[model samples]
Target chain A: MEPAGGSCLLGKWGHPVLQAANDTFRLNADFFDYTIIALYFAVVLGIGVLAKRQVSSSIDFFMSGRSLPAWVTGLAFISANLGAVEIMGMSANGAEFGVATFHYFWIGAVPAMLFLGIVMMPFYYGSGVRSVPEFMRRRFGTGAHLVNALSFSVAQLLIAGINLYLLATIVNRLLGWPLWVSLIVAAVVVLSYITLGGLSAAIYNEVLQFFVIVAALTPLTIVALHKVGGWEGIKDKVQPGPEQLSSWPGTDLTGISDPLWSTIGIVFGLGFVLSFGYWTTNFVEVQRAMASESLSSARRAPIIGAFPKMFIPFIVIIPGMAAAIIIPEITNLKSGEGDTGGATYNDAILLLMRDLLPNGMLGVAIAGLLASFMAGMAANISAFNTVFSYDLWQQYVKKDKPDAYYTFVGRIATVAATVIAIGTAWFASNYDNLMNYLQTLFGFFNAPLFATFILGMFWKRMTATAGWTGLVSGTAAAVAVAFLSEDAFGSASTGLIGLSGQGASFAAAGAAFVVDIAVSVVVTLFTRPRDEKDLKGLVYSLTPKESLVDPDAKALPWYQSPTTLAGIGLVIVIVLNLLFR
Target chain B: MSTDHDGTTDTTPKKRAGLFDIRFVIAGLIGVYGVILVLLGIFNASDEELARGDGLNINLWAGLGMLVGAAVFAVWARLRPVVVPVED
Candidate 1:
């Protein structure tokens, strides 16, 4: 399995995988687009300069002064959310599964956003907290708060670095730059704006970038569609039945045999675990909710955000699907001899974009691609700075520090995060794949965190000991699945309403959740509960009325709670998937 | 955190969230974006024009229009609540 020619890992050449990696560093024929890439960096830096003064306070620095309206929030939400990992991941899915991959948008994003708007935001805002972790503190306890804050920050930073690495790969393909140059250029451009402007700059620039991305993507889609012929051509060229694009659960009429309940398990597990983990628990997402002016605004922001989320499939994935049809010959070019295609998911995209777009327009498209990549880096560094400054530094290093000190710490945190992220990017450069790396990293902790967030919100009996137990148990289970399972959890478990490969990870996490919940209930029942004083803060966030005991105070209903709404949203998502499929 | 009873704060130093005047502007901005998206969908160029490789041109026109339209609506929304803040 050493170097030969981009082919299968276990091919006749006995080294196809090695050859693929070797060719990756070799510049493609269409390289020499550096001028366009440089222009993209300049625009990003300009945004940073424009946003320099917006970071005067911790609130301004982290939450954009909490005065932004729905559209800005909506735009920023999509921009910040996509990241490099997301773009490449989605495209990779498209290349692999065809239009069926669009299910992520339909089943994962749209419903998640709508549910957040109608339910989760109210609970989060009602809690009246600065960050998602702070809400955990009020709802559960300090231990829950601290652990979640620390773990999520670390995991997200890792995700950010992975995203930067994916971005570097694409940039390298477009400009023929070396991997190190692409990584450094990306880090500098993103860090410069982020350190100077904080959340305000991130949001403002994100709003602009969101538009730019759409502009680039929508056109790319049209060109791709035309190049491949229309819907009729796609139908003729690709598989038309469930074998290619089944959105429903397994055992459909596509005649393709599937793993047992692969569709149901993957989709449900993702919604119950991955979606909940990300939207309900992650700091970057929940932070946007915190930035709203009112609980109502917070509740509504994700809904507005859902509009774009719903169409993301058409914009991002369809192009990949189109590329798959047209460029099937080149697909898997990196897989070594006798492999599916020799290309990895990462390379498949660049090869397609290179072969497709006209030269002048390539500049704009590449810029949009970079925007997607850089946005992730900027948002993460911002979120990481906030966590360190607010959660760690404020609590220990500078408890009584001035606002000036907080801002300074925030900058320092940004620099630290940037350095680590650059390191992560360098580490990832050694790997040849994007989807496998991202899914593996996310699978490690996503399930456990999702379980804890759900338990903490709905079931009051969950205690600190239980939180610790659940997180640990969940991590252990996910790790076990990673090592022991056949598909390794994420690959086989993915779909619209059920598990994909990600579900196995969630299943392990779910098992941990069950154990944690059971342990917590028993512990809470036997051990005396924490003082009612500790419970008071939590009660207020949940019961926002004249009194907690009031019979009719017009308090927010439980149906509006994110946990409950997700349950209801799951049904709608399943139906949508079935309808579309 | 000290919360104000009866929706008014007298002794608390922490700023509270509410239906402040900025809300109406926010609601207005939402409406503006909604309108632009609807109009774009309605007045969209033919699928053929889009398919024949005018992707950037079409997206540029539509996205710019959306931005300008949304910005104008947001300004109007901001101005709308000014005339009757208390009543609102």
Candidate 2:
């Protein structure tokens, strides 16, 4: 398990050494950098003010009044998921695990995004549901709805808090700012736009933030490539083996180090279970697609997003791979238990920024980092507010409130959620291995969700009772596997199923999927099926063809169809996998 | 299918002034960052900065590119202001 450079023999306790190494990595922001960041904040605040006037009703606040074009929603859809953790964590993994990290994007994200657009959007958009849980209510009844809503609300709060904590920590560590100062500054900026402008403001800023991130980070990547002498140099320098440079799993050289998956695990565990569960069911991402102007536009949103999602690993992951070669001392440092005076792997992106980027461009890069963190927090907070206002509050606590009253409540919910998230962030700070725990938590939530959605949407024979049972048991199965696997196998073991963290998650999800399907099919066979008439629009077999098709799309060329576009994206992904392999 | 929750089809178009549109925010950001980069590249950058960028003024070029992008967004918004249709 030691790094290729070999272990540092500094002592059993590694914190002091790591702390000293961290101290060596400092970024001094000049006035120009501050000005650029300040201007970014001001522009974001101005957008919030303008968006505020647009929010006159709950629909406007929660769903952008369902009026955005495909392109806008598409960019925002992908951007909503691009948090600070994703940028930093992916690079960290790239540095630690190498090209195997590409599995997260290609196998984990692409296929699922396409499936959401091509198959799932018709049910979600055409059903006239305000939230994902509302669709659950329509298809699976009140019990299933409550389960989904409660889990989603809690997950969003925790995720938002984690993002907030991580971003502030990065700022404190890299720039020597106080943690509280960073937290307060972030809270104020995020609260202003989201409270005033609502979902529209959040989505618009996500798109803006997406561009800012690309503009800022793209140059850093190019510079890093140059510093390493180019792609050829990266190949020669990044060590251990050629597997570090390749994307395919289970090759002779890769089998020993890369735990991404076996081919079976990648197909079933990642491509089917975890990916489908996340991209299809996670409301934080699906909310953007739901906001599109028409059913057709909603379907097109994820397809448009898929193209960009495919390339993101290059921008985010490659830098880490390069860092592994260029800064092995820092990249190789292991945290916790063993004592080494080296930076943790999570510090990869910040290290790259500090070491490579100059002053003015450095400011832009930092602003991009800030924008990404805020975008992530905003996406989660916005989703939380909407689910709370509609699913929990309006459904149970207060009924038939005026649209204006619900809008007011949504804003109040946003504030409440942000406070709760800050508390969660503080709680999470106690954990030494936050990322590992977060992955387990996501597995607990998402694995069973895709199973429920798949059966409920496709199989009319699936009873509401079965739907509820499948979700509960499936989630329980995922949780049980995560806990039991850690106990049965040593903590350092690859996974219960002998895979890396992501691969283990996929293994857990695959187990959950099997459990969910078995439970759902057995329960449905014994119980009475829902009347077909009641399942209209929610179930695939019962929905009218008109509801699924966009008439306008018929006039476009065959190449412009969402299915066609997704196929093109898939082809590109395959080519990339082969090229890298 | 196109009806709002109030059970009526929404047909009225909501017109936003160009200044009030989100594109304006996007343009403002690009312009601000672009100008800063250009200024830094032209007047203040040291020889080390120039060398670090591999003898190309990345700040200058990237800044100019951003400015062009901002202008395109501005002109596009002016030519066709964002109008949300209340009805399908």
Candidate 3:
């Protein structure tokens, strides 16, 4: 019933109540561990300094001058998501749901990413917009653009706080610092590099942090898997249910409790609505692809990112699944036995690291945790400042400003956003499972945006009035659903409906998608459409064949073609799903 | 996907990563950690430490693996550096 035959483990899941102990970081991170971590911080700051020299103009700062290679941006694309959201959130899902958590990547992420690469990237890249809001401005005009810019900036700040809180959690665990002090320090570090070098620094650090995360988790997974006695060990122990062992009909993860509805929820709500909405429209991801050197590279970035994205659940989810049996507190939590001190599903990865890893390896894991958090937070801040300066401030507050003036504003925006993120971190800390909070945010922001975008892109008859009104109504509907549903908004909810946990978010997303499309369509029939000339590159039917894809693609090899590469990715993901299923 | 060129052109080359390659940065940092871990495995990896990992010298093995990965990245950067074209 304890952490199987070992005793050296000391660090526990950090709780504010435990702060009075004054020595909460009981795990042994000695001389070698400190050196390795110190080396990591040095490299991170050094990369920021080097990238600072590359910034000469606003474009260089905001969009990396659209000059990064496909490989760099590809890794950065996945890495940006690799933050606390992907690491802690998904792992928490894995611990709670077992192998069923594979649905997030295979079902929720991969197909959507391939869809982005094959379909959406060309419109984004070929149109030559700096950010997604600019594309909205061109396609639907000022109303939708203003709505998108404000909502997106607000969304980024809130999400950035999640990453910031988790990053500060590591500092709190590592040096036993108080959470508030750690939050400020972590926010400042993410802000400094981003403010100094802009997107290039963010991208470069992201690439390295990607590897840091991979390296950190690889060892932790191996050790954890070995400790739990591998696949058979997991099957014998951690026997939550048959549903937990398979990838189908994940009633536990979705919290729907019915087999058919859970399957439908995973496939439609998460796979179709939430995932497509997130991967295609959310600028946190789109900006990475948009930074690629050429349109060809831009189209390939997400596909290339998908290859690695296919297998990350192995390192992330396995350790979490093993945590249920490996950590005594988590094992206690896994059964109907409730509240084992302060351990929640979110502590699954941290608990595994504490029990399984020794000093040197422990340092690597800690560094990786920090890297992932910073990567996620940096991604949000970088995206926030860009949208704030370009979309909001430039258009409404100070039009006709010089490029240099905007760049200065962007740096200022970074400072302001990071500070605001520190404040928002309090809200994120309330959720035991971060995924519940994150998926709700996505349902609110991305689902409506995707509905508006897909409608406008395909049906050119969709008027400008339909665009903004649809967004507002869609978001309002999702809000209403969350408030109406059982415990979607945590303490703020009315708990009137049957849904809670991630299932509530799924219901809200589906409602948003359906409601937005219906509203946009009804409004479109009542209003005037824009001129056909303005809709060329923005609308799919009106765009020329040449602009949608590289005209010279036929001359290139199979590997160079986006279609060929995406096809390969799809095959691999399908195979992975079936094998796990 | 191509062989490494001189990273120069008649129209003035501006490398994608102007100062240093991302590969080198990753390789160097991971490789440095590998060396430190390798030393720790040799000198400080006690029997008690080994017991915690189920008799595996995780530091030594993981360190060696990282070193190999570092070498692969170094060679990759050497063979095919990023070829980005910047406008004047």
Candidate 4:
């Protein structure tokens, strides 16, 4: 009836024009929501049906027939990287931490991507493998493959669950629709496209959505900047205050906050251990590597993906800053009980959009939000089906199933993942209250899993025995830590056990990695190597004729090519730290 | 099964020069970092200068350097050997 929920729109001056503009965003007794949502569904369905004709075999279905160009794979790669959790979580972080929230994009993501491009991609592409797990088996053993596949799947499911929850949250807040209605509708839309189009459909739709989301939101940022009086207005509103924003070496360094030990601990444990481990091993991302058209393309996907990856802070994080500025009255409210729906900084950006965006633009923003959600969904579903069809089903169940059968199973896996994600989404409706619960669950599997993958990759000495030991040990350590802690999250120290919840999981994971590496090394030394022929296909880089034999040719003294670029980038990054600090 | 048979051999290299394009990789990564640095330097430089309570300093040198770096790299890559040949 009114433009927005505030008392102003419904009051005496509430006219028909404003009401119509508001109604576009307003979920309704009217058919507007249905009409728009149905149009989205129809478009995806049409693409899926079209993609169906192109699906000739398992390869065609899972990898878009492996005929995708660099542009297609590149776009899909980006959309897959940014999901519902990205928009909601990062936006929330932006509101809470201000500019410091941007550190995750710059510090956490960008370097990791470049390093992945240079170091990790070469290894993966060289392996000539279908999946990261397959790469694991060639380097380590089947044991490594099994551990990686299961841990990765669990992580993906948790991610999907988080995404489903965020999507439901947005829809629920907008229309006052029940969570199940939203989750089910989302599940159907996602499942339909992925099942029909396979990875190619996912990639195609993702590329479309990538453009849609970026195009739609990019202009809104300009308008927002304009409204906020450009640069000076932004500075006046929030000036990088402490507790709101800080840089890498700022509060953590210089004794501004803590001792050197705590600072070092954050850098080592959080920065190197947690961050590097995730970027290198995480499947939702590495899956893109497998989809590249060439070794070089595979290598470039993560790096190319890094470019837009840096802009995420500009597009998503700054909006939260703007939100804080325009909605300063609610800044305290964000931290307090004055919140609507699920009260937290997570919903702050959505709250801003609800208040600020004019009529037609609101629809576009909503589409961007939905596009982000679908991108995450398509990425995870394809990954799940990939692991399921390739690793689990192929290894344990019907090893000799036809490609067509695997394609069929890939579709079935999508449905199965959708069902599990729906249930997890329902549980995640309480995510604001259960942040620790979600993250702790992730840390348990992720910590040890990361160790195994990293050790397997860099250290050729790792063995199957070490792999299994690390996998089991990490999970047990994570679970035990989570269980013993007074806080819902795992503590690194306990009076009884002398370990905190966070500390325990880290120690457990780290110890497991150490043990896994040691065991793998010792066992590999004693045990025999795999068939050298099996290892033949690995070697992803294409060297020149002279360089191919010389092993040192075209090396360029390490400071001329990627290394030089990365070094310069690092210097600029340091300068950025000083400036932002 | 037929598709598996028809799949390109990943084990063997094409051996031919320009089989996979090195320029694309260089151009792509260069373009990526280029756009990122330039945009971040331009807008964020102004913001940083403003936040420093100074008059508008656009980080003109840095911005220009970024553009030059990107263009030089892109042109250099095109001039380098073209590998990873497409169907075309």
Q: Of the candidates shown, which would achieve the greatest TM-score relative to the real structure?
A: 3
Off by over 4 Å in 2: A1-24, A250-261, A331-341, A433-439, A487-500, A557-560, B1-17, B51-56, B75-80, B84-88
Q: Write the per-residue lDDT of candidate 3 for residues A313-359, one digit (tens) a residue.
A: 99998998999888877888878586566677777887787777878
Candidate 3: how large is its RMSD? 5.4
Model 4, runs deviating above 4 Å: A1-42, A239-245, A250-266, A334-342, A430-439, A475-534, A537-578, B1-88
**Candidate 2 CA-lDDT value:** 0.75
Error of 4 at A363 (Å): 0.2
Among the numbered candidates, top lDDT falls to: 3
Each candidate's interface RMSD (Å, one decimal) is 9.6, 4.8, 3.6, 12.8
Model 2 alpha-carbon miss at residue A278, Å? 0.1
Q: In what order do the candidates fall by TM-score, top score first?
A: 3, 2, 1, 4
- Model 2 agreement with the true structure over A62-96: per-residue lDDT tens digits: 99989887878999998988886678767776787
Residue B85, model 3, lDDT: 49
Off by over 4 Å in 3: A1-25, A426-442, A491-496, B1-19, B83-88
Better of 3 and 4 by lDDT: 3
User: What is the DockQ ranking, best to worst?
Assistant: 3, 2, 1, 4
**Better model by lDDT, 1 or 2?**
2
Provide the lDDT at A77 for model 4: 67
